[model samples]
Target: MCVISGTHGVEGFCGSGAQIALLEDAAVIAAVEKYGVAVMFYHALNPYGFSYCARTNEDNIDLNRNFRDFSRPLPVNAAYREVHDFMVPSTWPPTPENEARIGAYLSTRGEAALQAAVSGGQCDCADGLFYGGAAPAWSNGVFRDMLRRHAASRRRFAWIDFHTGLGPYGHAEKIHSGPNDAAMIARARAWYGIDVTSFHDGSSTSAVLTGVNYEAPLEECPGVECTGIALEYGTLSLLETLQALRGDAWLRNHPDADAKTRAAIKRRCRDAFYCDADDWKAMVYDQARDACLQAITQLAAAPVPH
Candidate 1:
């Protein structure tokens, strides 16, 4: 029921499907009521991120990375440590020094290594954006409560969290859930069809990470057989997206940066994630709607597996 969009601010384009067409699909609605399926659509999990055109929430926490128990031991993203400085630069966009450093790192480590290092969430840096919070965020609490309320009576659950900025442009990558139960995998393929890929198999476009929006429900609703999918649409190159994030993060941390510079950075970040063209928007909306309807129908109509 969590239609996750706006994990990155510019990715709001992906939210159009969940908010509008998917909710309107007649087949989806019929399937839901006909099979007694209850739903709770938590759209735009990171509203501040959506509005501000940044990936993280208002507290500078990546909503996806903020779900764990922050009071005790916080999970460390070791790879993130390697690229943290580059991600949240102390100065503005690509200073000559930074450009040289980043160029060197890319040359030595290669593109995927740079991506995996910087894109992964980090802790211990509250000032830098995308810092996973020390504890459960307000959104996390709301989601958990909602899951408990809506799913307590159900014996099965399915989730499709929408995303953008990976893989081929306009293609929707159906990323499999993290848990590896046989029945869960079967249910996902049936719902999303056979195109879905699991992280365990190394076929998925999504990188392996911890503390996602999906993992919470699985842990909380032990009674219900829960499965999750990330409907990842593509908008730009991964390098471009990462660069946008870098610039945006730099602007956020350095308040002394001029307004013009800040505005330019924001624009780049938004453009990198969202397509402003009318045709592009229309296409994204249509695909998202189709995906949602298919998910709703499959989840609602399918009989529980024994």
Candidate 2:
């Protein structure tokens, strides 16, 4: 079982915390020993994002959306292109007209359509939100190397990649992380329970994303029975989180901005993904432990490979 943190950089606070908590968790420790479950806690998949409190890497690549075969034709998101100008406007705080354009789009297309358009992993927009890079990132290659070195030997592998800035505050949405494979989704639901939701079927808060980090395991650990989810913990409302992301993008584009503006945008970016409250951390740790335990149990129960 792989418990990955920092797929989104700033969101690593909660995910890294949960990893520490799980490491010290008596039940988890006991289960690992009893079942011989190899729990690999990989931290800070995107160190640059984690350090800078930004969602994307230094290259503005969303690392979560950066894991794909770049040789194939990438998915074009014309919708993201349509909204790009307003989404990251000329100003720090978007003008009323810019927001009005977004509001108008939301009103006409509905929230789901807007989300799918905006966050469905756009390859065309290097400067836009959720931009999957035109080529494999250095981190992507390193991650695959880790999988081949440590995880390829396992017959049954389960992964939980932690994320933030979506859904109700403090709720951990277990989003099916692999491809739209029925058998894989069933295994996830069976291991993690019915709460496991899939974007492929519109059952998840996330859009139908491509180039997700989970794809790494499928490619790297070929033929392994893998089950995974992006445990997206909600920190703030979607709109607020989005505004934070915009502020981040704007900051990245404008290094000459004032110190106060820079600080405020960084704070906004961190706050959007990481709630510092004790109660919220407690909730996150609890859900994370539960998810890890579930995977451990399933991994233990599976028959040993011949």
TM-score of each: 0.90, 0.97
lDDT of 1 by residue, 258-301 (tens): 88998999899888877777766667767666666666676666
Candidate 2 residue-wise lDDT, 188-227, digit = tens? 9998999899999999999888888888899989878888
Write down the RMSD of candidate 2 (Cα, Å). 1.2
Clashes of 1: 1
Which candidate gets the maximum lDDT versus the true structure?
2
Task: Give the top-scoring candidate (TM-score).
Answer: 2
Worst ten in a row by lDDT for model 2: 297-306
In model 1, which residue pairs have backbone atoms overlapping below 3 Å?
70-134
